[model samples]
Target: MKKQKIFALILPVIALGGLLTLNALKADPPSKSKPAVAGLTVPTGFDINVIADKLGSARHLVITPQNDIYVHMASTRVSKGIVVLHEEGGKTTIKTSFANYGGTGIAMGGGYLYASDKSGVFRYKLDANNQVTNPENPDRIVTGLVSVDWHQPKAITLDNDGNVYVNIGAPSNICDELDKNRTGCPLLDSAAGIWQFRTDKLNQSYKEGVHYAWGLRNVVGITWNQQLNQLFVMQHGRDNLHQMHPKLFTEKQSAELPAECMFAIKKGDNAGWPYVYYDWQKQKNMLGPEYGGDGVKPADAKYINPVVGFPGHLAPDGLLFYTGNQFPERYKNGAFIAFHGSWNRAPEPQAGYFVVFQPFKNGKPDGKWEVFADGFAGTEELKAQGRAEHRPTGLAQGPDGSLYITDDNKGTIYKVTYKK
Candidate 1:
């Protein structure tokens, strides 16, 4: 069955073997009413400003040295797919839009702008201005990736080397087996892992990608730490902990069972999802419900551990290893994660609709994670997922040591800067 599935994934390469066809973005319509940044609260020296608003489905964003913004829209009502904003005179104006498909991966590297949809990955050659030279069509870099409704965001990151890493996220809850431990996963060969392709290569398929790392389950947020020269990924832990294993975990435990993890990935490294999940409360990796060990048993010694663990169901959306000299000296080399907010933490108030800063010393976490930016939801308490006024979606560091965050809910971009 696995062999047949693999073959089915590859047979479509011939049909999509060329540059992707795109519809150029129309000029951004006038902003009748922009969101106010007064609701946001940052550090003492920092101020947040709402730069852009009314962007539909703004999922991921990449900022250029010129301070221009490129946003990948998962679904849009005003524009096509990817929208570009040109920054000038303390204002960001919509310049153009390109690409027809909508999904969550966008990155700039090696003079190219890379973006992915549900299934395939594409790149456009960037001109000296850091703008796409050809917005109508782009080189199809990788094709034939799995694109089911589950775990199919295709979040991407590129190392300093020529490698481009794409997440082939797992489509099912724990690989389709709920009641028992399933070894080898069988799905490992097709999904639940990061596939490494070449930034310099074109028209490559899944068969061409090297399975760089596995057992990640779903990785929506990923970044390459240039200082440490390593790839770091944020894994969204498995959900429905108590509903799946009622005998062992309560609803509260289910809401916070497995830890949303941050991992420093190396070749052949695995975080042991499905069979196990890291328990932040226990400070150890515990066997998973499907694996027959309840929630407290220790996982096999063979699996690796997380570098940092966050509470369950935070839905961490973006990760950045702060390399720029922006902000205070303490922020240098730290990790900033944007939690898009949680939906499954029912019975307990939904948390994590803000950005967090985790300080690091010599490439490892040095202190407890702290909320760097808050008030995104605009309410004192969160009753449910979409109840928040704004949901933080993406994170970007600007050219001049500033942090730029995106809100997919209201399509607002907030620029945070510090002054002495």
Candidate 2:
């Protein structure tokens, strides 16, 4: 009977897949508003400004001490992958862009700007002014990382200890279909985890780097928390629960069961993907159906629980720990997450398309998370249709303690300031 039910759903699944792909590729109409803070919602005493716009697929960003901005472009208007900007007297202008390839991972450390394409990590020397001096002849630090068509972005961060961490996201969702016996997922050998590499090393490969952590399905938002002296990551939850395991989950249950989790990780922590998923409602890690259990069963004791679990499918693309003094004392040590929004959750009102703040106390989550800034999707109707005006993809902090957010949908760079 189970086999018959599964066989009956294959054609419908294929048709749905086609429709979803079409909807995803459909371009949204241009937004009409031109004001800096127009169509946005923020807390009192805070204001948002559009410092720059029309950048193509700006994913992650870094601000230098001089307040020079460097942004990674997954796609570009010109041939360059990194876009540089300079601000003076409250005005921002594009300085220049360089690099022959495009990607989503970029960081600055030790007078060098590090960037990654799909297959490798490269670094370029920076001048005294924090501008890339050798953009065309970057030194390849790490090479030969696995990258597929999806989940290919190697979101990166550097620690004060001269180490760089890169997230190699898992290609498969559940791996049930790939490893039919469910004994193990072969992809875990290289993907689905964070890998640590020395910032000073050159021409390093998978064998040269240490596998920092495993079992996280995919992590786009990653940071090294200086206060905690640990690595923190936001995991994107698995999708298609109802479509793949209809017997165990309803449509609503599928949309909301698994939680997008935040983990303050150590050297060998595992968050349990494919084998388990955190159910935010239960506040427990439930065994994945792919691993021969119903949704209610608890995951193995070896897997670590998340520091915080948010609603599923929020697609957290960026994470930044606030250490600036521009905001109130309450926000000094908190964390900000950029939700790129959700495409699934259909048959239910789609959600996300906002930034949220999670306060921290003594290097851990302190209180409930709150929406820090919202209305990126423009309207309820556009959000439901999965056509957003702007989707926040990256977060950065300026030298003067202002927060910067990047929109990948329409390429808008927002500067958020607090005036007390």
Q: Model 2 — which ten-residue stretch has the worst lDDT? A: 4-13
Per-residue error at 269 for model 2, in Å? 1.0
- The residue-by-residue lDDT of candidate 1 on 1-420, one tens digit each, is 011100000001010122221122222443333445445677777767777765777888999998778999877555668988766667566676778888889999999999998887899999998989988889999998888898878899888888889988888777646324355587777888888999988888877889889898999899899988888999999988788778898999988868999999998888787788999988898987676687768999888899999999888999998878768899999999999888888777888898999999988999899988888777665425447777887888989888988888867777888876
Candidate 1 worst ten-residue window by lDDT? 1-10
For residue 362, model 2's alpha carbon misses the true position, in angstroms, by: 0.7
TM-score of each: 0.90, 0.91
| Per-residue error (Å), model 1, residue 283 | 1.1
Kindly list the per-residue Cα lDDT of model 2 for residues 1-420, writing each as its tens digit.
011100000001011223222123232322334453346877777777777766668899999998888999886453268877777676665666677777888888899999988877998899998888897799999899998977988999999988889999988888777798899999899999999999898999999999999999999999989898899999999999999989999999987868999999999998888899999999999989888779878999999999999998989999999999999999988999999999888778788999999999999899899999887788789988788888999999999899999998767788888878
RMSD to truth, every model: 9.8, 10.7
